[model samples]
Target: MYLEKLAEGKTEIGESGLPPRPPENFDMTKFDRGRKFIQDHVICHVLAMFISLVCGMSVVNLLEPLIFTNNSDTPNKAYRRYISTFMHVTKWYYGNIWEENNKAQTSILTVRNMHNKVRKDMTAHEAKIKNSESVDIDSLNHERIASCPMAMKDVRLSQYDMSLVQTGFLGIVVMYPRFVGIDCTEAELDDFVYFWYGVGYMLGITDKNNICKEGFHITRDICKEIEQQILIPSLENPPSQFYPMAKAFIDGGNIAHKNKLNSVESVLAIGYHGMNVKLPKLSFMDYCRYLFLRGFVIVIYYCPPVKKLFNKIIRHFFWDSSVLEKKMN
Candidate 1:
């Protein structure tokens, strides 16, 4: 009947040479309907799979710290670990911030402006000093001595005091303008770097401050003192690479000094600041997640059993409780 219908031209023949029409009252749209149904089902299945993968990965990421521990026997490993972790977290946060707001070009401009302002102030101060006569200098020195009323007391400047002064001066030149209204010129910027390097040596990381204390072995106070006194000063007058601003001060006869400065500069510039510059931006939620993950890891990896038990209770009540509740009910 379908062939006859096709031959009589009452119904159109499909490519398969059968009548295109279904029986009267039949649902002719079933094939289209079935295809639509399958497509929707497949899409839903794919979406479910993707969601499952993401959820699984999140769980794995959360649990990763439990699976690894540092095996190094270095003194103050915990402190080192904390510093390393903080650096990592900071970098992640910094990068993410920039990624989210690509046009946020504030840091560089702020730093440059700060440099310019400090330079201008320094120039003015130098001019004032140069114009002062011998009488004026004597009078100024007398005033300075008079101001130090406690000179006869037990008032030797602490390492901290010196560090504060150095850092403060550098901050005025390099950092103040970024946060405040100061501007630094190229010379001031160089001076800032030189001061910081000196400060770094005083902090005890450099050769000059590497001596061990007499009795106590490497206490936090001792380390801090070393850092403030030794490491900071050693870092001062760094090479051009460490502080590009230092290049302006180098003379031909000061090859050894230049080399030492370069070495220190390379370490600080290429190492410390380099790491600082690469910090990532992170959303608050993401940061919280990272902190939670880190805390979880530290608890598992480093905490004593008793502390771990306490932490577990805290974790259950404070951190993980909501997550578990949501999963269950």
Candidate 2:
């Protein structure tokens, strides 16, 4: 029931006739608390971004037709594209979402506009092909068509896919809090879920298809199921595109941040630790680095002073500039 309902979201777009509601409908007090929860956990949030990217690349449903488009298909450009994308996400988390003219509201609306544009572009591409007398769809190689984004000629970006993308942000934190260093009360976690719920609503996710619609516990379960059924399987037997996309994501992030450690070993270390999955064997030094990162993450979570220091560095390095701001201006 959970997965099916979510799958139905692929056909849904727009506001679904629902007003934008923050936390008031569920728990009025959680609104501000929800905002603060995100504000206070910068490092964990960054880790969640890494996990989200890994999960996203693995999901073929999202990649082949939509994500596999020119924007992210190539390594050289994928990182810049994603960095710009997540910078907008960071704006929504940092800005006051409930305020009418706030960055959060503006950013979400902007993303909706971008999505609509992609749909139009894809549809137009398909139309041209269909009208071409030289082309014969029936005679085309099925594999070739399947590998191309042009195959999505008449398809619309469904609500189902958007919600899955939402899970990329929320699921890892909820399901593997320790991996991401999410140290908080049940109430705080609930607040965090509601926080994303509001963001999802503003992003034009229909109320019925909202991943956080059912609140924290149920939504966490839904995220877990996705990880088990879809995400994990895809990772285990990833398609050809996953390597280039995932490598590009890691490489781009490292280069943008001036991070020195983006080796295959580093990526493998994170995959093993964050997702609790067995991967190819690592060298002695690689294993040591993994242990160091794992231990460092634990220290950041348990030691308030250390966590505070890291959060400051994270904000300065990753959040100081907004890519969306540059684009909008």
Candidate 3:
């Protein structure tokens, strides 16, 4: 019955799915603590974002149109798409998120608009796939679509899908913070989860179906179930598109960093191997890069000066300082 309620979100399309307002009785203290959590551990949160993205490749087929079929045609465009994502996510963490017409609110609406466009495009594509003759189905296309657990079910992105995505962001950081070198208190974690609950509401996830709606412990348990049941399983049995899509996303990350050495694969490799997920053998050079990244993560996390310096570099490279100042003020 619980799963059924979440699955129902698949049908709650368009603006109708969004809550009329943000979550009520907003705990500003908790929200501020959550913002501090991210601010204090910026490098860890950034690392967690990469880890989440790689894990998200598990739903590549469900996300194909949003990814492959969108602004990812060229390396430069892919870079822009991811950088925009980083900025939006940062705004959610740092800005006057719940305030009307703020960066966070506007960013969530922009994302919804983008989702609507994809929903329209996928509707036509889904129909084409359903009506096409078997003889017209090529091996590559068949494999890609067949890999989707939600294939032929509904071309539109569902609330259930958004719930899973919400997990991608909140999961690793809350459940396995140490994976990204985070060492925080339980109360702080709760505050962080509380912040995202409000974010979930603004992102069209109904209170009943919001991944983070249940507060800290329940949300953690839910994220644990998703990691054990869906995310890990998907990683263990990914389709042909998984590697390509993951590589494309990492390539964009490299672009954002303006240095290929800062590959998101560093996080992916460590996280997957830690989880006992089987991966193809990598070249010797790839292994060397992973080693370098491991060392980099360690130095940045344990060394405060290095961590501060790294944070400044990231802000300088990807964000507008003025926007942060304005939102924060």
Single out the weakest 10-residue window by summed lDDT for candidate 3. 320-329
What local distance difference test score does each model get? 0.28, 0.70, 0.69
Q: What is the lDDT of residue 298 in candidate 2?
A: 86
Task: Report clash pairs, candidate 2.
Answer: 9-159, 9-160, 10-158, 10-160
- TM-scores vs. true structure, each candidate: 0.18, 0.84, 0.83
Q: How should the candidates be ordered by lDDT, best one leading? A: 2, 3, 1
Expressed as tens digits, the lDDT of each residue in 79-155 for candidate 3 is 66666777778777766766788877777777777877777766776676778887566545555555555556663
* Predicted candidate 2 versus true structure: per-residue lDDT over 196-303, tens digit per residue: 887887777877778898778999989988888888887777666667667776676667668645544565557656677776688876676667767778887888
TM-score of 3: 0.83
Candidate 2 Cα misplacement greater than 4 A, ranges: 14-28, 65-68, 74-76, 135-145, 148-154, 257-260, 283-289, 317-329
> Residue 274 in candidate 3 has what lDDT?
43
C-alpha lDDT (0 to 100) for residue 30 of candidate 2: 73
Candidate 1's error at 327, in angstroms? 39
Q: How many clashing pairs in candidate 2?
A: 4
Clashes of each: 57, 4, 0
